[model samples]
Target: MNLQPDARRALGAGLVVIALVAFSNSSAHISDVGQQAAVAAVSSTDTLTQLNQSLISANKDKGVLKEGELLEKAVHRKALMEILAKENPAHFLRYVLNASQISSLPKSVTATVEKRISTEGVIDTYIIDDFEHPEKSHYEYYFKRGANVKSLYLVGDLLVRSNTQALITGYEGDTYVVADNTKGNVTIKANKDIDGGSNEALGVQNTAVILVDFDDSGPRPFTKEQAKNIFFNAQFNKFMKEQSYNKVSFKGDVYGWYRLSGPSMSNGQHVIPVFGNDNSQLNRIILENNIPIGNYGRVIIAINSDFTSSSQVGMTMQYIGGREYFFSSSWISLAGFDILAPFPFTWTDLDFLLAHELGHALGLMHANSWECG
Candidate 1:
């Protein structure tokens, strides 16, 4: 069924509730002797038909079936597992049915998962089922692994030669780094949990806006006044205000066009420090300029350079000495095209990016389409 972004965001917020309901219902049914007999009586074909009917009913009602209610029927659960096994047997056997396999994974892979769990507290795993193509179903694993929010894909038990190649192929976030050695092709990806901050929402967040340039860079894409308008103007401010229901808002001053001391192009491409390095560099620059960073609660660094790729647009670090910061690579090339004008050339574009990165800074997470259903 079709759903808009706002609706999808709402669904994302309720995911924990849905998971709890589904787990509890499943447990109750598994413990019921009578329910087990009923499930056993239904043939696989009949069970599949019933599952399809339930889906059709939900579609007719213009609402998603509560996963708990849908899976509460023992027959439906069996049908789903059977479908999973028949389609994506590898994933079903390794991840779904075999809970113990996590520990038995190759040492490097097990260490990666364990490290994430140690740092992020607990790993939240999601199994997404594609009814139309069960084989296309996959998993999303979130590890509240970063001080600021980070997103990436994790491919486990993959038989590959190098972890670097795996990251180049499977990575899907703005900020990522290869955290482990390539011992047997196990790529472990991790990101911050959707609920990962304390005191993130509650007051007017003071922010610092810095526009950066490189020694070898060309003319700035936008004027300081234009950059100021993007951050402090009504469009972005009002959006955050309404989204937080007036509980949160941003106030900050804009600074920069400060040329850093290095060549803009790195190995024939414009590159900037990433991960904690970017934050450290910006912090140093702010201190050098005597900007009194302590005055702000958040920081936004806008660079007048093209990113290596479009997927590398922006990322946020929710905490740096109790303050938050996000970086936006202003210029980007879309779909392998040459570098175009600075991204967010229009008000709408800037508003969405600001909202999204700020949402991560505020402890919100990515919302996928499958989550809605």
Candidate 2:
């Protein structure tokens, strides 16, 4: 998430740098004039274009960018959108679905649907799919039944993009999308959610944290003790305790530096072998070695590999004999050892990485606050 020159200019001269310096120095003060300048600068289409271009460029260079850098860039992009929408409503509305259009969506169609807006301002629609009973189409019955259901599925949203009023529905890779106004049947292609039980996240959570490396990879830079500290240290533990009001806290054992069979290098570049979305092979190896995975409520797999793509650095799902687990993989170079290292930026630490993915494993979703002002 290297901020391009164009994006820096769009944000007004030196605002990003000043803000970063302030954050690093623990300074809370930002002049009112500076805030006004940022708002004014972001209210133009040129700023939006520059920010969008920066994101595109960042995506192309994701292999070189750390997860924290990517996250910072995303946050910047979202902030720019929020400011622009608030300062220039008429201009912003030209790109996204407006109140009238959002309200006009058929109640029957939206009855069991959940809608979310992306940072790019596109509306994404998700529908619930029941795995136990394939005949059931809507999500209401399961909602009313509480946590009694054995199997439930939540498919990723149907991304709807439009320049005009027409709505079209289709599939974007595994997830569905709507592109035009024609009413049609949606065929679910991806299962984004698999619920073993809704109440699994409550009370004390016992986790099994496994660190893995590809067979051809080097020794893990961090030791088992360092990895254990990430989850059990006072900072993370206190934060979790406060957030859940002491109702939820984790007790976990760290295991591994386990080597999974895979070609660490592909085409002169390092690669991590992942079977589709979840690392089924890693799960299989753990089970085969008699790791007692079923005893814990959650499992966290930290891979010693840096992600080449920006789509996902961590993911969570119910798998491995229908047990809940999350896979978190990010490169932590030797230089990234500083507790407050600024090179990889913030939120790249093993603590943050595990906690973030663990949030997903606990049924939490990414926070979204951008809305039309």
Candidate 3:
């Protein structure tokens, strides 16, 4: 989706940069602050007007929605946001439920998540949704379940986003370990550490993923230079060995890295990395381009740095896991941490972030305290 340069700048500045704590080989926790958007809140009426204009532009560009129909939907969405805000507003980790889907869901879940969803966890009731899409509005995020036959509600995202300190929660096969105890807090621990191919990890196991980025001529977010240092650094590989009590060491070669340029990384709806196991647009592109897929895991990392052409959500990573490491992968921003961090940052912090996420992908759950239980 193309965004005008001016508009991207305007929104990116306000999009919250959620800074989270990355764990060590063990899920060591810490007191951390989310790098939230610094913009001042505008009146709801004015905010709705801007949203309405954007909705109109998006619909007109997509050439979808009947005359005034998109506006009606936007009005409904704005109203829903208001109602949801009253229920609990304070937007961060922004989310909005599909009105239609909500009605259809079993009463048990709708009752639970509807009451729990919010933007910033202030119980301020602010939630967000991309309702302009004719069919695939962001509101209806879903993932495949048994036998990969169909997509089911990623109700977990809603549940976690809606509630606080949501730890040890698993949906489908993926688990949510909000180890840090903060809103938008996430850590991935997969059980496939010991058995690289097994869906779950017995002890400490080995896992692999294809981490790639677009070869944009502009500055890179995480340069191949920087990625190599993080991925192949003596300490990084050493850290992996240490994670398994020196049993499962990645002497290198556990993951492959590539950079692609051109339209392959351009098509498809943008995917915001999340804690669930949904295949992203870049993953599809990788498949079409014949990138080898892993048996135990499959994911293509696309480092999107084009603020002028991208929707700016702070740094995020997504995975799909059930059992042990059925399939898990992630896409991360090049400069998300650098841009979001309030303190001076370096690769060490970034390395820990990777380590922490790996811990989650391998089936570990978060602890209420500083430990990874």
- Say which candidate scores most in TM-score: 1
Worst 10 residues of 1 by lDDT: 157-166
Question: Stretches of candidate 1 above 4 Å error?
Answer: 1-197, 274-280, 308-346, 370-373
Better of 2 and 3 by lDDT: 2
Instruction: Encode model 2's per-residue lDDT on 171-247: one tens digit a residue.
Output: 11112222211223233223223212233444567777677777755667778887777656645455455445454
Q: Largest lDDT belongs to which candidate? A: 1
Give a tens-digit lDDT track for model 1, residues 85-178: 3333222222231225333333332222212211322122323322233233333333234454333233332211111112222111223211
- Model 1 lDDT at residue 299: 60
Q: Which ten residues in a row have the lowest lDDT in candidate 3?
A: 118-127
- The Cα error of candidate 2 at residue 179, in Å, is 11
TM per candidate comes to 0.42, 0.41, 0.39
Cα lDDT, model 1, residue 360: 37
Q: Rank order by lDDT, top first? A: 1, 2, 3
